[model samples]
Target: MTDKPNESSEPTPPRTQPVVSGQAAPSPYDSPTGEIPVVKSGAGENVPRTEDELGLDPEVPGVGERTEPIANRPAEEPTEPVTPAYAFASIPPAPAAGEGGLRRRGDYRRGTLDLGLLGLRLVVGLTFLYHGLQKLAGWFHGPGLDQTRAMLEQGGWKHGELSTAMLSVAEVGGGALIVLGLATPLAAGAVLASITDAWLWKQGMAPGFQYKPVELESILVGLAATLILTGPGRLSFDRNRGWATRPMWGSVTALVLALIAAAASWIYLHGGNPFTGFFD
Candidate 1:
């Protein structure tokens, strides 16, 4: 019968059908699309897989809950990085200060700026008050009304009596108002005009920063201008009456009015022209 088949080459046995209660089980479902369904372990579906079984680290660095293979997992939409719950335990960061780290509210209160303005007001206001008293009644070792009148006439004041009286009233009344912080704008304007008028008289046709030593008129003018710009502090009558903290427009108007009054007073006293005295 020719060469006989070797024992090692004997025919392999075929797979037998699995039986369930004496009936044959059906074959696995074969979809037209050929997609394979998920498989589970034989121990049970609810049981968790340990690290030994999965061959992965027990404490992976950036991993969260729901341990599944990345390839098998469904893709998720991207979102912003989430802060952990424990991150809240740390203190929150502080906010940065604005605008060159300055806190210039410029309010009419007893704060840093208010106190400074108060001090300045007292100094200038009291000084002017003393001068006013001196011109009015010869107090503070200054010339009296008669001498003031004589000085006015000598300084080219045509209507000496009228000019002298106006200056006296302006100084005395404006000084009082400034000291009390009442009608601050009005007080500042009046005082500023009076200082400018005196400046003209004192210069007496001199030109440009000539006389040194004290420079009383220049100092008074600066102080009065500051008041016009800064307004009275919270400690003044104006603050109490809601007239303090006037805007920039108000300050500009006050300065303009003061200059106009000063020019008028100068022309009235000089009779001819106050401009001529300012130049050579």
Candidate 2:
């Protein structure tokens, strides 16, 4: 007998489907629409489809389809645009001077200078006050107003008694004000005028610069003028009471009044002609 070769009965495995990231691949043995599974035959192989199944797509064999990979899919919605948020910061302002007892601009209230100036005011003011008392009230062995008037007449004052009395009043009043550091400009003006007249009187009568006749008067004028330039010290009544005001215009006004008073005093002393020549 001739031996015929028997056929081995193993079925061929189906081809693998291509995989996408977010999508599932169709099964190899599944129908085109993936609705039904293919059945196996007695020979252990996929059952062949009928003409009706092939009618759906003549070229493709199973449920597997040619599609774009998940990496290239455009189904994802576009990301939303981001917006930034902001908040305003709050800042505080500095305190004002008047509100907290702070100094204003141009206020010169140095402690050391105030102490020195206060000492100066005391010495000058008290000395002038005493001298005024001597003339006005005959205190401290002074030539009373009557005697002072005679001395003034000898010095060529048009009205010696009136002039001497007026000088006494200014000296006494101004000296007291200076000592108290009240109305500093007014006090300085009065004292400045008085000293200016004294200097002119000495220059006119003495006629020569042999000796500095108005030495004490010049010193007094300098001190008074300095006080006008610099306000009273912190230890005075004016400062404690908030009256120690020293503005630029105040100084200017004090100087102008002093000069006018000096001119008037010179005129009263010698009939408006105190000097004989330019140098004199």
Candidate 3:
């Protein structure tokens, strides 16, 4: 008999299957909708397997891990710092009585200035009116222009008649205008001219302290200058006509003009006069 074949030592033949169109073999990780199956190791092993173990993103932390819902994050809001309501309020009170007293004193000084200006105006007006009337009417021992010219001729004026007439006109006309506070600068200028003339011509011979005629006139001129510089106080027609609120620069102009006029008068009267040398 032929040697019996060793059935236990026989080699197994390879099996083959036909390929199907449009179909794939099911994967070990395949699952139905809405569920993921957990993978495990071979039998009797305790090790767990995850998608990450197969080099895939793990869904254990939940799906769409990178695309977090904005609602779950903390919100941001723009806020401004709160400030005290009275931080920018008015200035606080001064701590010293001296400051308060100084403020009050300043107010009082302003009031006094106003009152002094008013008084000066009234006195100048009355005095001018009186002298003007005396010269115009030859009243109260006032000499007529002809008599004044004769007197001035004896005192060394070359053109006595013209000088006397001009003096009378300035005195009367300027006085009336000053009293009315109309064209006050012109009036003051006229008065200044007359006073300057008296000081240079007639009064120069008189003793310094004797009943010097020009002394009163000089004072009057100074007062008139003050009025011209400051303008007629609130009681005058200048104020009523809205002409008295002159700029401060006008005072400078007035002062400059007055100084020039004064210099010119002095030069004209005394520059060539031999008599001025005697006094000098």
TM-score of every prediction relative to native = 0.57, 0.59, 0.51
Model 3: worst 10 consecutive residues (lDDT sum): 269-278
User: Which one wins on TM-score?
Assistant: 2
Task: Give lDDT tens digits, candidate 2, residues 1-280.
Answer: 4597875688878988766578666666666656666798899987768877545545554557666655899887888888654456355556755763454544565648778878878877887899899999999999989999988887778777679977898889989989988888788788888878877777666655523777787788788888887778677777853335444776877878898988977775555444552235
Give the CA lDDT, 0 to 100, for residue 13 in model 1.
Answer: 98
Residues forming the 10-long window of minimal summed lDDT in candidate 2: 271-280
TM-score of 1: 0.57
Candidate 3 on 76-191: residue-level lDDT in tens? Answer: 78889886568677988567877777775663444455456557766776676666566657777877666776876776665666666666777778777777777766676677
What would you estimate as the lDDT of candidate 1?
0.76
Task: For candidate 1, write residues 1-280 as lDDT tens digits.
Answer: 6697656766889988755587655546544566555557696563445678667776685746576776999989899999666755677656477653344443423357667777777877787788888988999898988999898787677887887788888888888888888888898899899888877666656644455522888898999988888888777877854346644787879889999999887776674433344445
Lowest summed lDDT across 10 adjacent residues in model 1 is found at 100-109
Residue 177, candidate 1: how far off, in angstroms?
0.9
The alpha-carbon lDDT assigned to residue 190 of candidate 1 equals 91
Per-residue lDDT for 222 in model 1?
91
State the displacement of the C-alpha of residue 272, model 1, in Å, after optimal TM-score superposition. 6.1
Which portions of model 2 show Cα errors greater than 4 Å?
1-109, 240-246, 272-280
